[model samples]
Target chain A: MKLIPYLVYLLLIAMHEVIWRDVTAIHGVTINLAAFLVLAVALYKSELTVVWFGFFAGLILAAGMPDRLGWHALALSAVAFTAFHVRERINLKSPFAKFLLMLGGLFLHNVLVVLINQSGGFLYLVWHSALTGAVYTSILTLLFFAFKDGYVTVRKIRDIF
Target chain B: MTWISRLFSRHSRNLHLVAILLLSAVLIYGNNDLNRYVNRTTLFFSWPFSQVRCSIEELSGVNAENQRLQQSLVEASLRLTELDEIRRENRRLRSILEFEPEPGYSLLPARVVKVVGDKIPVSAVVINRGQEDSVLVNQTVINQEGLVGRISEVWPGGAEVQLLTHMANRVAVRVAESQEMGVVKYIASRGMILENFPIQGNIRQGDLILSSGLGGVYPARLVVGTVASVEKPEEEAFCKVLLTPAVSFSSLQEVFILRPD
Candidate 1:
């Protein structure tokens, strides 16, 4: 509903890009920015804002990464929609809930991406990727929590007025 | 208001599902198109941020490199003196052997100023040398260690040296031991592959591969690289030989553009 959260979203995206610029593993793991954006939108739960942010976030992710178009858009929109539903019913104001939801979304998004890309039954590769994705996403989710509270408090205050 | 609500709202859950499905459709469509314009536009927007990050990284890299370079320069200066003495002795021995030195083999020392452009398989290194400095197209370029590549395009103040590892380059090379001639073609997915050579001729690992004088582009006996592997698969048309290039492209700082005789 407010401009502050949108600005916060942009800042978060930039921070993610800068932080996860380098690939650490041989197979490599992406930071899943699109998934993060989806979670952020769900955390806020304004449908129009979520859709617009998700679309733009999809565009950003698609542009920076050489992956085929629409993949990120599909994934982000799916996650965002799911998150938005959860946000509507549950008290998702807690950082722990946000982290768990994001962790699950990241797991689903990466597995789906890997499955779509892999034509052959490369089980070992897929397994390794999933494991790496889990570990990396957990760490990123923890870092996301470390920064979440301050932004949430500020937004809550703005919303109360 | 009721009509608008009915048309637009439905059940929120169903609406959400439809939105996701629509997004998925859009995403699949976008990927299928694979439009270069979208990708480039994205890159353009993000370039400034990427540049800032690159500059910061480069600044730190340059500082560490400056210290190491200073130390290396001292060691290299001493090595140069020793090398001069060895070269003089070698020249004397060559004179005794009646080995006439090839004319027009003047080495012009140049420094790499920038990497102007890069594609998947092609990259051009812009050197400080130009036509003003007698740098011409097809001039054999080499570092102190071994062959780098030839000057591809010569500008008035700068020239582009197409590294030997570039996909477009192919050098006619001869095996130093067996004297077997082969064309060294740069394959994109793979490194330099020696193609269209004599099948009977055997090439072992560590065999010295050099530029053959047949091409008239690069001078003969310039060290290209050592053969890393020799794969002779039966029923295949040509031997699948891989060569590790002598010069490292990413680390190139200084090079000499040798005038082809």
Candidate 2:
């Protein structure tokens, strides 16, 4: 059901918050569940629903982090919308293509957030985010792709029967 | 329909343009203060999970004890030394606290939930006690070993205790043996410095450092650290003194926040 997906999304976001609260990974990646969820769902569903989901996730993220209000909501929606658009242009057939696209989108998201935060020491933040995002998102993108692909295939088989 | 597919493709390209515009507008106009409020609120909501994480972390320590018994014993021995030091420091703090508690001296017991690493210039430990427990800002905290640090910020169910080693932490202390005074300055290469002590003060390498009572935030005479090295120059007006913290903050898992009576 819809509730199950939302719960799973919240759990992942909570887990990310727990692990990487005040700290960034060596390469400067901060785990972002809001972006990850948007990417996962957009790959599985339609554009409009994914956009709405991203907004909700953004709301949850923004609620907790008081430093940037609508910034995240805006960033997440943009990432979801772009991913949906790209899926149609290329053959959404290959898992590698999807993974690559996710990575690219995540990199863009990180860069855009850094620019908004206007955090000093600009060079360090950008390079660190790029390296860290690629590594973390690649691992996550693989798992989500497999899960979504399997679910869709199973649904197709069930419909035929 | 095939016609529907064509129309969708045509508009999908435009969707990217609209998304970018919206994103730029939000970034330009997003309220910074609101974002900070959201962060604070998010932190409050995440408290339950951090508590769970801390409990799990504490459990791992117990599980590690059986596998690393020898290591545990060695740690225990170190703790015993630490306990003795704590007892001596407690007596010193009590004498200082006895003289006159600045204004409101409320004591509370808080357990260390988590120690965030020091990369952020703000090294903090999450304590189980919070606003509900009447833990307030500016209250002095000390372990059995020595003076820890003051409460910088507080939450409803938990609070963050900034450790003595943090870059911004400075304590006023007196040399126990020399009775000479200086402010303890944090040094990157060295642990701490007793800067501006009179050149004539006979400060040995191992002389003890105690709070001078000048800093109202910390009750005077609490053990801060010990002199590690002294820098003396004949031409200079004051000597530079280095101190090693009395409490082994790295291994500190529990501390008692002194209730000023």
Candidate 3:
């Protein structure tokens, strides 16, 4: 319930959007850091916190494009609400289950973004851009899950070295 | 903290959802200035890191360009050396503009393809012209400056000249001022000395020595060298005269064979 941590998370989202987005992109496919963070908050935080954070994160993502501000905020909030409910209904005791939740949430957010921007036909973008981006984000989600589940550790890596 | 817990309670969830929806609707239909202000605030917070990323990329590009410039510098240096050689050849050719052979003989231009001796101011040379070009043995060879030597042995496509630096090579000469005749010969240690001139011959340094036409091989009045020093040694019969050869044999490039008309 501390307000300062959420503020710090929002700052991280803004930093990723402004500085790391282009640098981390792979052959024109970019990581959806904003959606991933929103889904993460939905997984662990209260419903109200996730929803507001999702809205603010979308605003940060669309900072350069003012015309799509409202649509992006609405789309991201909808994804966060759905992810929060899915987490509640589904048994997420397993890291794989939480990873599935993150992947599904990110894919949903990407599709809505493509739809809101009218980037192209839904089926065409679904495989090429949206699904590829979701997969890219999901890899990061799996790494985060591994760290949280203690499957990987810095000490273990050093021991190998 | 109590109010925060109450806000996350099940009942307040619906109110928070409605509040998020209303905020979205207001922003979507609201004036453009509101959205722009929010965007501006976000970008202002991220501006410093964006500048740092740009600087890093520019530094990498400069590193690649530095490698390219090093390659270009090496290429330019080789080109400059080639151009300097050509410039020296150009100056040599310009001085050859006034060159003419003797009245009754025609000059055949030939390049010195190789020198045949180990000594500096080489003792012999091979010219590009040979028997195929009407070149034969014992033909006098001269450059625009003065005498070089004579063709010694001829091949089909080339001929070698016995240069005046050869110890056996001799020229019958006379001082231009006194017309006092002498014989010029090469000595490895003493170098191009006038061996057979009279002790009292009117010869001195700066006097021009020319071929006297006494030896049937070389023509009359063809300059061989200049008297560089004159010493009437008490023990010697002839004046001990040292001459600086007109043609620098070491740097010989082009010459003319005096083929009889």
What lDDT tens digits, residue by residue, belong to model 2 across residues B22-103? Answer: 6535544666664565556556546677788899889999788767998878899999999999997787567545543336
Docking quality category of candidate 2 according to DockQ thresholds: incorrect
Better of 2 and 3 by lDDT: 3
Flag the better candidate by TM-score, 2 or 3. Answer: 3
Model 3 chain B is weakest, by summed lDDT over 10 consecutive residues, at B41-50
Decide which is better by DockQ, 2 or 3. 3
Worst 10 residues of 1 chain B by lDDT: B92-101
lDDT of 3 by residue, B188-222 (tens): 88888887898877888999999998988899888
TM-score of each: 0.44, 0.40, 0.83
Error of 3 at A37 (Å): 2.7
Put down candidate 1 lDDT per residue, A109-140, tens digits, no spaces: 66766765675565765567655675577677
Candidate closest to the true structure, highest DockQ: 3
What TM value does model 1 have? 0.44
For candidate 3, give the lDDT of residue B73: 95
Which ranges of candidate 1 are over 4 A from the true structure? A23-30, A64-67, A88-98, A116-122, A143-161, B1-27, B30-34, B56-72, B80-261
- The candidate 1 chain A region of ten consecutive residues with least summed lDDT is A18-27
TM-scores computed on chain B for all candidates: 0.59, 0.58, 0.85
